[model samples]
Target chain A: MSDTSFDSQTREASFGDYFALLKPRVMSLVVFTALVGLLVAPGSVHPVEGFAAILFIALGGGASGALNMWWDADIDRIMKRTQSRPIPSGKVGAEEALALGLALSGISVIMLALASNIVAGALLAFTIFFYVVIYSMWLKRSTPQNIVIGGAAGAFPPMIGWAVATGGVSIESIMMFALVFFWTPPHFWALALFMKSDYSEAKVPMLTVTHGRKVTRQQIFGYTLLLAGLAIGTGFTSLGGPVYWAAAVVLNLLFIKGAWTILRRDEEVAEADNYAAEKSFFKLSLLYLFLHFGAILADAVLMRMGVTFGGLL
Target chain B: MTFRPDHELHKRRKGRNIGVGLVLVGFVALVFLLTVVKVERGGSLQGFDHTQRIDMVPQGSNK
Candidate 1:
């Protein structure tokens, strides 16, 4: 085993390590939501341009993830969950990650401009900047609200997808953005509840670390309620459909149940087998967002078939 | 340093793994290169213009 000490010259990077830095999982989520946004919007986009937009958005997301990995290498090294990450494991050098991130940032933004309009390109660029600069550099170390604000960066993909379709932002796109924005706090807080030691060890000011566990639980429930409201309400917008509405209702109920159960558990009960309640909620949160977007895609398909739902039905 | 019984065998297998990995990487690169060429020669994004307007509704109906 390599020495645990942080050193500049100890570990050489492999291709897999570099790939891991891109956070391919997160990038996939960005690509899917952005694709849904583009497909469901009212306006038309050229097929080539739409493909390019999604490609660029995915690359931009990857770039942000790379930069985040670069910046958080220190804290990542200390945290068990992140210790195997490229930078922390010394498989990829920080400078290389930074360079890869910067290069991809420029390429993705430029390609987006060529493929689509300037608006989509600009949004893509800003999303990268927000994740790398605002979220990683500024908020992450300074406050527990890091993920809350950084969540906006993740939220931009849908809006960019909308811009690719319409060449402008719409209320519908913003609603999708808001859905993600509100959902982020509770999702991440649940994660923090389970991974409290990870943050505490890294000296990161997660909500659970800065505040007491009870406060974090209450906040999680509060955000869950807000997320449920926004999610259902968002389905009433231009993008909403019977499929989306049904999905939202089911997902939100599950999400609320998860949050409520987490709230009711004391630390003793939660930590009985290593924060089982909190961990389960965190895992479910990932599925919740994905199912919601999947429902949106389904709704779009159903709407295309000329199916509408009436109150009685 | 402590050595497991299979350490030498594992070390020997590393070369084969590296070779296979490189070949896979090369294949993927070649595919990407062909795609870029095709994209450049052919039109954009596989020419998927689903955005073409189909006008069933009267243009000035809203007006």
Candidate 2:
């Protein structure tokens, strides 16, 4: 071996550096949604298998994040919001990140198969491939609809969780999938509204960058309508109850209002980054998804409590 | 600045190599322990044993 202290000096190390590599922030959402899926699905998965499945799902999500970082390091470094990520900051080498990502991806998928079922494992494999290959490698730079298409990768967790329980897909599981899928465009475009410069500087074809803000705003409203319809529609499924329906109605109304506010704002107001509307919408979107899932959870609890609303009028 | 200090570099690299090797061994050992526990427990450590009576239909009503 040759002295690598010189190389070490060229790099840096810290606890935060490693945490950044794992994409902890993104992992939190992955863990949350996956847990909701597991909880709401009818029937039982052994507690051990359930926990293990979720753990592997989270690891798989992190693997995708790491691979995304490795591939997008160039744009990441230029983007203000993403500048301090581990690989771009020289805290971790791109090669190390890639190796860690691939290894984790393999482990997560294989372990999920062993812990749960093949259907869930297959979904996990496809999720990793879709995000790392389709979204990160292709759509991200090549098209303005990157987030819209890449959103499918994020939407798979609940369906995978459903598969773990029911051993297959169904209308209910796919509805959960569609909720996330349709919600992604507007949720992401809202951020794009405020962070317009970052995408432009990074040369990433975010909707706000590739198209004008007016067009982006219009699409946001359009998707919000679509998302609300799907969300409300889920109330009619076996998975839904009165609580879920009420929650969906309230959240969708607020979400549409937020989108409308942004659509109506002018350059001066928007550029001042009156994130008042954009920021609120962004935060509300997070709460909206969580609440929708929470409603499902509440419905499950209600059913278990003998509080069925199907015949209450 | 034309001096070659390859020997010192090699020694330092050897030290790093040992440290990294130990870390990797530790990680593998940890994972092995976790895998054993997971498999023995039938794939999950947390058992879903809580009883919750599910109401398939509304009370006093038939579907």
Candidate 3:
């Protein structure tokens, strides 16, 4: 009849706690882009293979998330944004996270190879390693260019999906990679502009914290312009069609406008308005990537139905 | 008594245990389905899991 003992038990690791270590939100993005990449590729995939490819790709992403939590536990304790993560909140042990991440990494790689081509499996393995080792361990706390480099880790899933179907890399896969890569800096810099305190407190040298907000805003604008050009240009490739072209034109115009608005504001105006422009830019970025991939998927479907979309070319 | 009372640790970790069980089951099923699909598509027995299964290969196989 001791409440103290039960109080301790209340904080013990549960299934949900372990799941939280996987960073399900980030895994969802990996799944979405990878699924789009698979569906939009030139060759056809067996449905089961496609399902297994996405599943293991997601597992690989989740494994990296767990390993990232394991590595960043110290800073997660300090950052308000990451304070409630499993390790920081004491629901999961760092060692358990390391174990789960490693185990899942091996299983996912092997299973993906068995279920699909070795190309996809190898890319998934490399993605996990790049995210956990290169980005999380090496670059994260060391440089202002961390997000720029780490974004490559997030951008690999779609490429891996493309590999699953075609069994090799291609121009379209590289384009998808470039799309996510260029989009990452602006998207993260916007969050950094508003959540400035988190990076400073954690001593993570984010672009905003190191280069100052004015420069960060400029970089966001610069990257957004590049992203707009790349996104609009992707529509003219074999990946693009009338459907994709329309989506790209509208999305990029809105995106460039958002980035321009962010670039125009100083911290004075941004803080006065509670970072409304920066926050909206962050929200739009989520849609920007999703709709770009969605448009590509729609184009692929139309092509499958024997409809020529070169009229708007 | 064949059915004894549950241990306190077991009672506390029921959800975790069940979740792990389900995951294990799902993994087995996925592997099974993958094997079936690979076989149905006329894939060789040697490279099923990306492993070189020499024993499964014929004796005179110059692969």
Instruction: Point to the candidate with the largest DockQ.
Output: 3
Q: In model 3, where do residues sit more than 4 Å from their true spots? A: A1-11, A310-313, B1-12, B43-63
Winning candidate number (lDDT)? 3
List each candidate's DockQ score: 0.07, 0.07, 0.34
True contacts kept of each: 0.00, 0.03, 0.45
Greater-TM-score candidate between 1 and 2: 2
How large is the interface RMSD of each prediction? 8.8, 6.5, 3.1
* TM-score rank order: 3, 2, 1
Estimate, for each residue in A1-313, the C-alpha lDDT of model 2 and write its tens digit: 3356566454544444544676888888788778878878888877767887898898899899999999999999898888878887777889888998999999999988877789999999999999999999999998999999999999999999888887888899999999999999999988877765677777778788778888999999999999999998999998778889889989999999998897898668866855678888998999998899889988988887787886556
Off by over 4 Å in 2: A1-16, A310-313, B1-63
Please, what are the lDDT tens digits per residue for candidate 3 over residues A42-139?
88888988898899999999999999999999999998888999999988999999999999999899988888889999999999999999999999
What is the lDDT of every predicted structure here?
0.82, 0.83, 0.89
Residue A267 CA displacement from its true place in model 3, Å: 1.2
Candidate 1, A174-284: lDDT as tens digits: 988888888889888887777646777777888888888898999999989999998988888877887788889888998899899988988998878798878888888
Better of 1 and 3 by DockQ: 3
As for candidate 1, its clashing pairs are: A13-A91, A47-B48
Higher-scoring candidate on TM-score, 2 or 3: 3
Measured against the true structure, the TM-scores of the candidates, in listed sequence, are 0.79, 0.81, 0.90
**Cα deviation of A205 in candidate 1 (Å)?**
0.5
